[model samples]
Target chain A: MLKKMENNTGNFYIDVASIQKEKHANEICGDVFLTKKVSAEDRTIIVLSDGLGSGIKANILASVTASMAVNFTSMNAPLAHTAEIILSTLPVDRERKVGYSSFTIIDIEAGGTIHFVEYGNPEILYFRENETLELKKTPVTIKNRFRLKQPLFYSNCTGRRNDRIVVCSDGISQSGIGSRAYPFGWGIKNVNAYIRDEISRHPGISSFDLCRKLLANAIANDTFKAKDDITAGVVYLREARRLMVCSGPPYDENKDTMLARDLDRFAGTKIICGGTTANIIAREMHREICTNLSHTSFQLPPVSSMDNIDLITEGILTLGKAHRLLEEGFKPDLVSKDPAVMLCNHFLLHDEIVFVVGTKVNEAHQDPSLPVELEIRRNVIKKIARELEDNYLKTININYI
Target chain B: MTEITICSGTLCYIMGGADIFEIETKLSEMYNDKIRIKASTCLGFCEGENKQNPPCVMVGNELIPDATIEKIINHLKRLYTR
Candidate 1:
């Protein structure tokens, strides 16, 4: 069997997560964040940029800065040269240190080493276990006509389990402004204290959940209205946790015993999709299937549960909705308390995903007018697999039976 | 017009169910003009490792497991006659 996990060469797994606070309900987030996973070296490169002011102007500047940083890193250009070129082109403020658009470059490897580079934006917080890991800040000026005093920070730390590196824009620190509770704003001290408290309260918090918790608090501190456009990136290193999802049914009934045994022997979570597939597995394994007839998704049918199966749902429609959700974007609160949403969240949480697809087509789904054929259904699975790799940075393997 | 799709997936093709491919030339004279015969990577019906029903075919949305050429032709006749 081909290994579905990326832990073959590396001792650590990287969970890269980010969240952004938009200026308004309908406007694009001014703080642009980009993440690219280098397949050759298994390295994760992240760039966060906060443009001058907010709205479209800031969005454009931040987008340009973030993309340029990503492009430069992919080309293996010198960090200093890339920084110099980015600063020279942008209109820097005389009062601030190479100010116009601020950036933080984080290059993390699967082997537990952190290559952190920061300029203009707020300091990157390094955390190990629960407490903060402080690095000495040394000011290295970027040579320019205005004598730019950008802080050139370079630090390397070998990551262990539960090691986290957080980078954020000024918007996070500037939260709670104009509020009675915090006359100035939620400073770096408060943010650090909150993070430390959360870490201590709950161990093994995921990078995505941690980033989201901070963003949510920041927004709430401004009395349900964010004081500024905020952005946060939380990168974590740990061992990989693999998950197996068995969907559809095999082509022949004679193969049911092997399929049942495969599910029973799977070390990770086993999910059975489709009613007929679940029934076969249930019958073969002699396990009771408790189905929840509650309509979970508006478009898709409700979910079912078996004694051993982690999750069970109607096959194609649920997968379709899950694919759409991932494609549209990763928003935790999009469709709260739904089966498809729950499945998508589970998919995001796991590092590796194994899809066991059954090559059986359902007659109920076929209609002359509907165009729900075997080919269309198989295409849907392929589309879902592609979205998982592209959007979530997960290692996925598809086994067709 | 009727559409006849044969499952050519790993399980179906292996079960000798994909024999529809061999008889397409013979059926072309009798029903080729009235029906569309196509081979699909997976006709979506043989999911269980239980190859009890090795070959599968789809006429419209109806699945015919343990499908043979005669079974498929009869299914097509029934589908179109209705």
Candidate 2:
């Protein structure tokens, strides 16, 4: 998951994700994709660069080009100057005598304005509501002191909600170069058609999934062996997916009503983590919780169901286990009927997570006979929040009741 | 429908209620729609007179202490036959 640009002016949330596949038999990919969020300006810059060949030399070239493109773009350097610096900095190949690397730069501002610059790479594909958008591009020519004149394309447009911008290396556009399936290569036209079909089928497809699908198709076009380094970067503008998790019970019995009221007013998915916490909400809202014994996991207590709540589980233990799973880099395969796994899945699926933790201590957990791993509720919640923010790039907010 | 509520509180679970939960699948296969199984965070009975006999389970209106799969199944069979 990509870290979202905070304080976005437009209501739409920007999701940026990418995938890369190295050429067959190569230890490292020759294509490099870099994304940097300029928090001060509330802007994001993405750069994709593909070098001349495969292996170490190409990898270094692509990395240098991509890093320079990201830094120059973020610094607001003139388009021509940025191109000149990148072109002059690229080292010439001893055999070909040509310093070559294809690059695509995308700069998106807070108010939905986007500026794109492309050189040697395929033109970015823009989609709005499952339809291809035609962006007018101006050709730019840079003549530098090295007497090397390079042609670059510049385009700018405003982004709308549900709009998607996809940029790729030539490897994606030329996946099946010599294959009988695509005599001249996969081509941009076919790639655009595939994306259109994908959008029509799943209107709410995320940038990460879209990029993965695109890369998979590109590799298949090469008969499951990529001929060159392939990379796809997707920028999606859409409404954010939010989730609210209420754990533990408030310290003061008087504040129980307040917790329930806040939960009732939440606009997104809701979860209750503690038995006492769920009881408080059920009592205040006059609702019932029906536990599902069939989904019980040996390691954790069975999950329960409540009105208007997405999931209900045992607190401390589940949260502590979830924190450990995230720390070890949780994956889909690790998922089971375990409440901790379910909680981790919910945290991973949403873009924004709000944790409403109650400060009250559960007297039962303080018993000496109980396992020592039963950490304090507040401490466990804090650990989970930190893992989500630092590792998973999720937007997290904690409210102590 | 025979409603079976199993206590899944920390104390009950630790005392063998965890294994009793799997009876849902067994009861469903044997009796199907006749059994309605659910779990409760705490039946509030574990802290009282029957605290020593935990993993508690309630079948219909009858409360059974020290619940096991066979014991719960026997109770279910009796209820279904009635």
Candidate 3:
């Protein structure tokens, strides 16, 4: 768990919490900050991504999405346009079909303007003094028809001051406070009322605390374990804010040079790499890279920050799909129109970023030197990028190295 | 000339490996003047899970799984030599 106080023009704080359940062999759902950067005004902008399907591949989709979104949103571009650019930029995997991720964006301006947009999940609830609740649900949603489920755009209502927004995945909802499957097709009012009546009570309670209560409520209601990874993000708005960008170990050996190059161009350059990359990069750059003996995974850098892109990814998809439905002309009080949201919200994190690193084939029992299916995968990536208007970085930025 | 079929459906693409299309390209390059290759939407087998076994191949009435370029080439070689 990590906490930071922002000294920006606005008074704002954020409390985030995520929990994953072993839903089976293949499903895992979590949240991720695609990328994080402090805006010129010193406020923090966060984007969450939820990849389609579950388990490791789903984690990678959400991870890459959060990383890219965080990296670009810092530029303070229009969220809609920035989202479009990101959609266009992702590399599509032929096996997983990686063109889309459920996205939710929270922008805390210096003056404390909380702009919230969700694409998949429903609007998070704000519970405060006397159980006064605020639910900023999107006006539209993507509903899954029997067949022909396509990505749809939706619009979001503006944010209210000091409104605590609780964004989450269906896993959180399905788990529900009572542990009975979330009353399918239940509206935000029902969700909000349940939280207010059962969970949120007390002033200045951190959002993360509220998240825990919500998850605990769900678990306590039923005797069975959750079948999916559960994720929840809470954003508290006041007036002040600060931002942190968590970097992780490189997927490839050349990451040392890449880090040096990226750090040279960006200000407040803090190089945080993990494990072998951490040791080598820190030694070469003369910077400190945090170490953890508990986790041997190569993705220790960003995960070390506790932002845990895996969790954020689930939040993004649930929220992004919710937002898309609103944009496409659905009402928050109505049913969602997108089926991808349901399928995408079902997974957990991967041990490493897939396909991007290692030889053409690694330990997956394939030939290492051969490019396997590069052309097909590349085409899928290109088609998605073109359709979504995302800036897919086809070539690794050698300048970073 | 050799005829090649590439299935782009969900299951075939998934079980067949996304890189299966390279087989056609490799064959084309190796026997550039000898074969004609193209892509098709679905081979009717990928729709149901039953037809989705590994290395699924159809030559006349023969269904081959774990079908590789070598196997494909040898089959073609036999037909051509005959």
Candidate 4:
């Protein structure tokens, strides 16, 4: 998996989960996927299936369907046609088995264009910028051919960068938890709202953290000790690799001189600016800067802002606008070479410093109020930091400070 | 008098034959407040282990597996007619 991640391009990610529970002799319900990043071409293929029934049989059903779909798609089959073949070739229910699996396929190119094919209820949700969309089959399940024939056919669509795509099993929408034991499925309607809140809280979060938080919340809401299998995948897109450059606080008292000198130098690199730093830079430059609220350079006849200051505000707004511009089904990725960054004179900033009172002899001291064992906190924190370091070298910058 | 409780989670619902309300209606018509019917959440009986032998309903202390409308009706008739 690490090898695959290292070689993958275009910021593609996938998540898979299942449970063999004591509640059911056959935990047949869950999802299966055959995924790989085609590094050379920067295209990623993700084929997923939700098997019929529970336990081993259901697992086999979904596994066969996913394996076949991925194999065929890798041969370059078109998304819709590939889905049709998988649907048609199944057991066909001739022996009164009444078994079939839901399937979806997505092919994302290096340029961040997403092509999707979906059949059955497990849907593909797109959250671009912060707007979400669901590309799903009709709500009614396709148990028999009669149901499959109506306008209830599966759907296919394509989208572009700064857009996010989420694929989920029906289990997530159906799960229940909490005092009222409310269902936390987020369904199609609330998946976007949920993602937007998560992204806003933890802007640099990895895909794994997002998936874990969603499932954990679902479990907490469920009254049953055991829950149905839950799975959700998030893919964020951008027109170019987004570079968030954090400038350290200003080193000197000459604020205007520092801003004027530092702003132009960073601007010369052509990276757009945002946040408070962009505003400060614009005020110092004393000129109107160009920017777009839509974040899309393609909007209208292409309205560009007036000066460098306006341009920097436009850039900051552009990032916000980019997040705002996404509706459901959009996948965000670098669509162009325009990288967006924050402009600053190192820093006019916010910093927090906490005083520590600990047993210097122990290096860590136990809290009398905590019910946990003496060393549990230290051990748990160490284990989590180790895991974070192992999985996400990019996001987990483990500086002790 | 016989008491019946049915499971209401997603799988049991999918398995169908909940029919608790109809069973209650039938009992009220036949026994006139002599019998009681209730709906409950999952009894933790999932597929595979039950091997699709579910749609469970508890009648007193005895569990009726693969419960159907006919099964409940028969059980109630046998217990209450006496």
Candidate 5:
């Protein structure tokens, strides 16, 4: 259990999230991210770097800069030295006369002492319960032996449960720069007001969704064809969420008791997938399996229920169908209340996902009558793991038993 | 010419190692011109009443279960060498 300590304002847990958008049909996004320290119990470190240009070069530059930033922070290097190193090392665009990479670093210690540095990047907007808080920054000039000189803006603050910090690339702050919508760029003032309005309306949005919303609206301001690579990193301090999913069953019949006991022992919400797997757990627990013969998708099999299993589903069909739905972007309300959708919602809502995957293969999954796509069990689940990590930024632990 | 069908469907992919798909490159690299590896949507094995051992691979008319790199390569070597 996490002991709640009072920060300057209130006690809360830290949650950091980010999302990216490449300009137009470009394969490479110029924005690179560093979130290596978020899972640390006492500290949170997140950095977003935007390379000078777009595509491969930009990606490489941003990647190098973000990686170096994380490494330096880990080594506890001075911010001035770190800034000078980056400014000198990164190549400059000849015509633009600008360093190839710019980054924003947000570092928060336990008990919500927030420290951040912005270098040639958009200023981050801090909020406290739908009301905006203006940050006070000190400019530090960085110089190295190479005679390279660069300046970085540094700031510090205290945070509460409902505080949100949104930092983004110029793609967001300068969205629709020359567009007819505003005739001027989507400046900091405009972005600030928009976020305040959004917070007031939703109030309970997760940091991930808030970042996504900001990026989406920013891209929309650029008329879907973004003029730049848009990226937003959101750090939201709030309560914690945890979830556990049990999919498949062990091939060894002897371990059924172990699997059942594991599910029963799991403190978080438990989801059991696969009809046979659910039956195995039910039989092991000496509980009756109740069949729910309702319809989620007419083409897929119906759902089932048993005691202690938060969700019971028809193995591959539910997983495959859910993968397709989630692949299209997991929208909680849009998905019907089927086992798969319910399971997807469970995955989306929680911060931590514990996947207990049984190696047992269900004989029913190879049926020729079913769609070939439904026959995919491991691959789809594997895809789900990747998608959850990449898109939703959920921490997943796959326990293969 | 030999017809080697690899089941790309889910059950076989999972029950048998996902490496079953990698047989294509190995077969191609070895037999060069003699073997043709193709993906079958579903071979109707590992599910229903007609389920068979999987991950299933077909070497011409013979369907091999739990097809491994060594097992498939040995069979190919036997058939072509003979």
Candidate 6:
């Protein structure tokens, strides 16, 4: 599950993302990854569980363990109690003679405190400022009636901005098992080295992209065929990437300068959606709108460029099409040439999206003969903002001028 | 290089500038690198008396009102011949 949650810690945003690959020939991944944000509590919980074997049975075991881990942790249950519940719930394997599933639970509070618990899973790696930190873990043994004894490791730490917590299943650490290069396995040491090098090379890599790179490397270690279900989750605390979208013209013509001034003052990616809106900014800033003809799409109008503006496009039509694409859960990278897709991509990629919507109604669109789909500018922006917030978990702000 | 500016404003786009953007393929084959084409947001020409003419294009210093692909092509041809 790829979900990002914003922390109200004021200085940093908490981005949590995960990527998983099913074992070779398995219909479903035996590893289950889950994330949830409790808004009232201002807490985020991430769970990753790897089952005993590959295929559907293993998937069910992992799913049950992961879901229970997330719920228990969110409810502030004791670690031993959570482990007991999970162990009792899983069905025992006939051959192994044990109900088997390995899980890692990460509970992050609003004040930067992280509670990490692991049972039969690889240790989570904590990195800050290009160096990995050695986390102190306390081992606890849970003696329950159903099972003899289960060992769990608990670690509590406070994270700062630019810190990352990476958790993965045994499948990742055990990748390339029995292979000549890594006869033992691609152990945690190699994974740590790879992550360190990646952060050094790309200092600002997002948590989602880092997980993708790690997963790709792990898949390659197994000679392009994973021996078991692999899962990698990264929780990154960093400054938020913001994008401001200015659409339509301001309600009052005199306030056009105010729009331009706001856009100029914004210290983030800037996108102008409407022609008149772009013109207002261009004229006020004394910049030229250079239309990009190379990447023209028949479905949507071609995108344009201007000084200090990241993207410029035709307003209502492009926005409407972009809204539809976002609603469809379109991936912008696949067909990025379209103006609508480009807009949607910006909205998804950024941590926060701010829309500066102008309220002036264009007389041209008022014609009843025009397509009824030409909704009012504010309504379209509102729809897009809603989709972004609800589906993608993005922080959205719409200011109607 | 000859410059052609197409108005991508709302009125111009609805009037016919949408098809004018397609003239790039034809112009690239005809003029090669001799012409540069760009689009601007509302050239501010479609107001007052100029409101009667839309889908405006600027070919060099001359503004072609109610522009089309063919008209822009003809204007480009004339400019190249000169």
Candidate 4 chain A minimal-lDDT segment of 10 residues? A346-355
User: How do the predictions measure up, each by TM-score?
Assistant: 0.73, 0.87, 0.40, 0.42, 0.61, 0.92
Better of 1 and 3 by DockQ: 1
- How many angstroms is residue A78 displaced in model 2 relative to the true structure, after the best TM-score fit? 3.1
lDDT top scorer: 2
Which ranges in model 6 have alpha carbons more than 4 Å from their true place?
A1-10, A144-146, A332-335, B27-35, B45-49, B61-66, B74-82
| lDDT value, residue A274 of candidate 1 | 66
Provide C-alpha RMSD values for all models, in order.
11.7, 3.6, 21.9, 28.0, 13.5, 2.6
Q: Score the docking of each candidate (DockQ).
A: 0.02, 0.40, 0.01, 0.01, 0.04, 0.46
Tens digits of per-residue lDDT for model 6 on A1-401?
22344444456778888899999888899999999888888888999999999889899999999999999888899889889888888898888887888899988887778899988888899998999998899998986446577678998888788888899987789999999989999999999999999999998898889999989988998999998899999988888789999998898999999999999999999999988788789889999778776765454557889889999988888898888888998664745577887888888778888999999887757667643446888998999999988988888999989
Docking quality (DockQ) of candidate 5: 0.04
Q: Which residue pairs collide, candidate 5?
A: A274-A315, A363-B47, A375-B10
| Tens-place lDDT digits, model 6, residues B14-67 | 778788888876664768778888877778687655464787999888899989
Ranking by lDDT: 2, 6, 5, 1, 4, 3
How much does candidate 5 score in TM-score? 0.61
Among the numbered candidates, top DockQ falls to: 6
lDDT of 5 by residue, B1-82 (tens): 8877765444555555356556665664657778776654345566667667677888899888878777888888889888
lDDT of each: 0.72, 0.86, 0.43, 0.46, 0.76, 0.85
What residue runs in model 1 are displaced by over 4 Å at the alpha carbon?
A1-10, A22-29, A92-99, A136-138, A177-180, A252-254, A296-299, A324-339, A360-377, B1-82
Docking class of 6: acceptable
Task: Give the fraction of true interface contacts kept by model 3.
Answer: 0.00
Lowest summed-lDDT stretch of 10 residues in model 5 chain A? A292-301
Of candidate 1 chain A, the 10-residue stretch with the lowest lDDT total is A1-10
lDDT of 3 by residue, A218-325 (tens): 554334465455566665543222111112334466665765444444433122212232334445556542212222221111112211111111111122342343
Q: Could you tell which candidate, 4 or 5, scores higher by lDDT? A: 5
